[model samples]
Target: MASVVWYVCLAGLLVAVSGQIVDDCVLVGGEKKSDVDVAILAKLAPLKNKRFEAKVEEGSDTYVYTFVVCGRVITNNTSTNEGLLQTKVNSKDSSVIGRINETHVISGSDWILLSYRGGDKYDSHCGSEPRTAMIMISCTKNTLADGFMVIKEERSKSTECFYLFEMDSSVACPPEESHLSAGSILLIVFAVLVALYLIGGFVYQRFVVGAKGMEQFPNITFWQEFGNLVADGCDFVCRSRPRSADTAYRGVGDDQLAEEPEERDDHLLPM
Candidate 1:
């Protein structure tokens, strides 16, 4: 039983360490399309009742954007749950645009992740360039949602480039208050003390009382003194009134007093 308890404690410690690691590094996002990425900074914007700006950058071969969104989440008063801050690159023309929603639903303390990939379908034409888009969404709290669209221009392999788009959201969920009551804590402490007292009492009764009883009889141990007392009483009674061969033999030397009684009677009568 003790080994089992130790193992359980070790497992809990390992889980806590692992959770800390993941929380520090991995960006929270939805698991399916249409599902919001909770890790993005933009997700938390609404929770603060403020609008945050999105930063966009265009590279020679790819474009990148950073944004913040706000949502409800469980956190300390000073901190907020930064939602998904994603970076995506269009493999074709390098054209990129990023957008993220500011609002989200409060579903416990879990997070979400949303992902997307380019598809072959053309959404529309931008200027003279034909645009196609694809999207994928997933949630950490539950099932993934429907895919959202992202529009990108088509281009030849020689001119093909990548476009990167990033969306960040923040959500804050209030921390839960402790459920333990003062009375409950007191009761637990009282129970533990009572158990210890009972154990101590039992040990004292078995060892201390028994040792004192043995000390009362100096000549013999307690058990040996009890046995000798019983034996001496039996011998005195059997010798005083013999009923069997063993008793008769024990009384043989004492029978000389019986003969003296007969001799005294003869002397007192006419003889």
Candidate 2:
């Protein structure tokens, strides 16, 4: 039983760790420029007949970029309330340059208002223009399509990076979302369940089993009571016996208590 419980606990731990590793890998790979644009963008809502633009500038130690994304969330028979999203990233090293509000409701009539400004540190050895980078956007509505969005400089441009202006009409708004990741919540719940199970098992073994075993045999309290009863009976027997130690050790003889003969009567006549 103990071994089984241990194995279960170990399995749960492994599962939890694996889930954590996967989540971390996703985030890290997403941050890397090598990540697939479609994979990253799959998380956002789709856009239709919309265009995106990137403007870049070099500061003292960093490269700054501003993104303006405009798109409408598409809804069909199966979905509703598509949201428009726009986000910006710095090119030196792909980090969130900035994000607009997470959920922008896009009705058939509303155009997405998306703009963000963010920057990354510049590498001194790299050329004046930052390397090519990608942005991914996703939406919950299935009607929304996912694709790659890229930022790069024109071939001949030295001081200016690439500009982007493309319209997508097939995308829809992302579904209503929550802050907590599903995997994280599952891990927490599993941990709590395992903890409770262990605690309950421990308590049952300690109190219930011991109590049942004691019920079938003499307890310390019963033995103590029996001891006191025997002690009282022995005291009564001792009190009833003769008090003298000599009498107790050796029995009294009646012949030793008889009087001895007198010798003084014959001498009184001569005086």
- The sequence of per-residue lDDT tens digits that candidate 2 reaches over residues 1-271 is 6534443454354434432222212221233322222222222222323334443444534433323332222336632221222233433343333222221221221122232212222244234433222233433344343343434434354443323322233333422457779899999999999788766755665676664444433344666789899998888787866555555355657887777877778867876
In lDDT terms, how accurate is model 2?
A: 0.38
Q: Residue 34 error for model 1, in Å? A: 26
The numbered model that scores best in lDDT is: 2
Candidate 1 TM-score, C-alpha based: 0.23
Give the Å error, residue 171, model 1: 15
Candidate 2 residue 145 C-alpha distance from true site, Å: 3.3
RMSD value for candidate 2? 19.1
Listed in order, each prediction's TM-score against the native is 0.23, 0.18
Off by over 4 Å in 2: 1-115, 124-142, 151-271
State how far residue 31 of model 1 sits from its true place (Å): 22
Ten-residue region with minimum lDDT total, candidate 2: 101-110
lDDT by residue for model 1 over 1-271, one digit each (tens)? 6534433454355434432322222232442322122223223323232322333344654433322222212235843332322344554332222222222232223343332222222334333332222122223222122222223423433332223222222222222468889999999999999787766755665676663543433334555878898898888877755555454345546656554543346657775
